[model samples]
Target: MQLLLIASEVFPFSRTGGLADVMAALPESLVRLGVDVTVLSPWWQSLHGQPTEVWRGSVPHGGRLQPGAVRVGEVRAAGVRYLFLGTPDFERPGLYAEDDVERFLRWGNLVLPTLQSMGLTFDLVHGHDWAAGTVVAHARAAGLRSVYTIHNLQYQGRWNFAEGAAWSGLPAAMLPDAEFYGDLNLMKAGLVFSDHVTTVSPTYAREITTREYGEGLEGVLQARDAAGALTGILNGLDLDRWNPAADPDVLPMTARSGKPANVAALRAEFLLDDAPILSAVSRLVSQKGLDLLVEALPDVTRDWNVVVLGSGDPLLEAALKGWAQHPRVRYVSGMNEALAHRLYAGSDAFCMPSRFEPCGLSQMISMRYGTLPVVRETGGLVDSVPSDVGFRFSGGGAGDLSAALHAARLAWDDRPGWQARVARGMALDFSWEASARRYVDVYRQVLGA
Candidate 1:
């Protein structure tokens, strides 16, 4: 099957979060499964990758005399075609900021038309998040099959309706789904307009249909669930990159034999002088429950050494930086790909206390490296890491944080049991083959195959 995948960010080429990693890995897996997949994303100035074709084009809106022009480049990476649709706005430092909708709409409009002009066609269009949803909405309007995946419902892309209408060039009548509490919610449009809507996990899919977890869009998801158009598929890990056995980031080690050597190497590298090392590689944001982690740190770090690497929320950054001065804590600001992998393989345990996670990749990567996870029982964390695989705390609050960290400490104390859990976690397969199969099934369903 031929598929058109539209996403806001992609790994190696362009990235800001987990969605980019998903976009990069999933296409490669799909290609391996005998599917032709093409990714469409914006080409920023910082992007440094080789492409087969590059075309310059314009997207006109609201009868504007001077349209937004972008340089669209087509590159094949890891067996999948990448269509990088870049605007001058994307050439800036930040990917999302003021006037994001206008920039995204311009990029969205440039995707299909560019492909059509190049004589390329696809059986299905798969859009990721609200930014890419504009493509699916346009596809639906022009009678095309499309699938929309809700990676995170909380970021619904709500903005001023007047501004959105003006930028989108869609009539007020055409903007029904976009309306959300006197604003335009781009994610709502994707959920309502796409042929199929999917979340990252089965439990998350169920959770989002409820009043508490829906973030006000539960009613819409409920309607779709009633119509039997909603689905939940667990996101998979890119084993090629995450595998501890072959990873370049950490001392080469497999789940079976390299634990002692890898652990020793990690400890020496991070300067953890005989202290049990615990690590968290994540954005310092409220949604990630970093505040709760911070609160729990004093108690946990009294016994374990800690290291953190990530960048977000200036307040959280400041707080973590201050905490890093503690005898047992070390904080590395900003996202580093190699360092993240090292943390996965080197640390004794991994922590992910997300308030609500769609599908967490860090925990999965940690599992591959035999780094036991200490996580909150929510979303993908619930689905991916069972109690036997790692430590978990139920609920979403400070109490949950304290409880989870305690459990992790207890697990860490029981050497034999902890080893067993870590071994089991490492054995668990999260390869993209399964996710690709599910996506293929979705494509077939959309085509009535």
Candidate 2:
């Protein structure tokens, strides 16, 4: 099957979040399953010197034909073709900002036409997140099959009709699905126009159809669910990229046998004295529930040495930084890829107490490294990290997280039990093969092929 995968961000070219990783990994997986996959994404200032094929096209916009040049950078990676589309406005310094929504909405007009100009054709178009939805919407109008996946319902890409809707060149009469509270919600357009809808995790798929997590599109999603047009496919981890056997920064450890050496290394680097270490590699955002971690620090740190690596939300950053004053609590204020691997292998436990996680990669990585995950029971965390594999707590309060941490400490003290839990976590498979097959099935079902 031939597939055109559209995304707002593709790793190694542009990225701000998990969407980029999914875009890169999923296409690779699909190609492995014998699907002809082509990924399309926006070009940004970060890609100024990258290799690409350039072409000029004239798109009709604002009651006139607007002449513009579109750049298509081509790269063949992991058996998939990646196309980065660029225009003058897209190259203007940033991938996303408040004003970028309208620009992206308008960029939808550039996608299919540019592909046609390049003689590219596909059986179906699959779009990701909010920014790329218009491609699916456009594909639907043209009588082509399309699938839309919501990576996170948190960002819906709502915009004013006058400022951005006019750029789509789609008449207001043809855009009833895009309407949300008298405004244009691009995510709604993607959901309503696509042949089928999907989210990152099954739990998240169900959560988003309810008022609490729906973000004001519950009615539409509820209808999709009733019509059997919605699916929740769990994301797969790239084992080769995250495996300790291959990662030079990390020593290969199985079931915590070799974890002590790495733990000593971490203690030496962070000036931490001997106590079981609990590490977290996450953005310091309220959504991540790092604030709950801070609240539990006083009680949890009495016995555990804590180290956190990430940066976001200035207020949360400041609060975490304040905890750095304590001898056992170390907060690294930025993202370091190598350090993340070390933390995964070295820490006694990894904490991911998210308010609502769609599908978290960290817990999987931690489990793969024999680092037991202490995750709250919500969304993918519940699906991925079962109580037997890792420590799980219900409720979204600091006390709940503290209770889970306390269990982790008890488990740590019980070496045999902790090792057994680590072994179980390591035994779990998270490769893209199964998930890729599921996606292929979705493609076939959508196309009736």
Candidate 3:
């Protein structure tokens, strides 16, 4: 199959979150299955890797033609071709502006014509997130089969209908479907026009078709679910990238022996005394339920040493900042990949008490490192963290999370029980190969193969 994968950002090029990781691992996995894949992404100034310009053309936007070029990335990771859409609009300082409507709309308008100019043909085009949402609409309109995956439903790209219609170059007839409550919704366009829609997790896919988690698109998701066009494929971890066995950030592989050295190293690094380590590596956002962790910290700190690494939202940052003074707690603001790897490798237990997690990768990463995950039973957390590998609690309250941690502490006190759970976590496979096969099945189904 010739598959065109469109995403706003791709790992090793430009990345802000998990979407980039997905674009990297998924395409490679598909290619391993002997499927031909070409990835389309914007060429940001912050993009890594050298790329050679392959095609130059004009794309329609606001009733005029704008110059754009397609560049092929030199990285050439794992047999998947990388194509970047380079235009002056993307040459700005940041990958995205505060209001992304106009910028992404123009880029969306460029897709069909850009493909035509390059003479690139694909059996199917798959798009991810709101940034690539418009590709589904454009591809479907041009008679190409398409699939759109929602990484996060909260970030629907809504804009003024008049301006979006003008810049997007979409016809009046399609506007009704694209518009949500008088605003042009790029996510709605993708959801409506694509042949099939997928969310990050199976539970999340079900959640979005309801009033609580739908983000006001419940009816549309409900119709898609009824028509057998919606799927919830759990996101997978890149085993190669996350393997504790070969990870350079920590000591070489072992499910047991290497863990003690890493734990010792982590203790020395953080000035922590010998205690069962509990860590949370996240973006420090309300969505992640960091506040709940903060609330539960007073209860968990005496029994466990805590490590936190992430940056976002000032209020959440401030909440974690005070914990730095605590002797057993170390709060490092901002993301550090190496530190994160070490944290996962070293920590006895990892916490992700998210109110709503759309297939969290951290829990999977933690499990891959043979660490127990203390997660609320929601979204992918519900799927990945089984009773054997981790601790789970229900409800959004701090009391529930505190109880889960206290339960984890008891298990930690039991050496035999703790080791058994760690071994189980290591044994579980949350691999991309499994997820890719599912995607291939989706592709074949959409193609009527």
TM agreement with the true structure for every prediction: 0.95, 0.96, 0.97
Worst 10 residues of 1 by lDDT: 59-68
- The best candidate by lDDT is 3
How would you encode candidate 2's per-residue C-alpha lDDT over 1-449 as one tens digit per residue?
Answer: 88999988888778777888788688888887889999988877676348566566664442233565666778777798888887777766766777777878877877887788778888999999888777777898778899999998888888886665677756566687787777778888899999999988999999989998888889999999999999999998988788876679987676646777888888888999889999999978777999999999999998799999999999889988899999999999888889989999889899999998889889999999988999988788877997887999888899999998998898789888888888898989999889888888888899998
The RMSD of every model to the true structure, in order and in angstroms, is: 1.9, 1.7, 1.5
Q: For residues 292-402, could you state the per-residue lDDT of candidate 3 as single tens digits? A: 888888898878999999999898788789888999989998888899999999888998999888888999999888789999988888988898889999888999999
Flag clash pairs in model 3. none
Scored against the true structure, residue 148 in model 3 reaches a CA lDDT of 92
**Ranking of all candidate structures by their lDDT, best first:** 3, 2, 1
What clash pairs does model 1 have?
A: none
lDDT of each: 0.82, 0.85, 0.86
Q: Which parts of model 1 are misplaced by more than 4 Å?
A: 50-52, 59-68
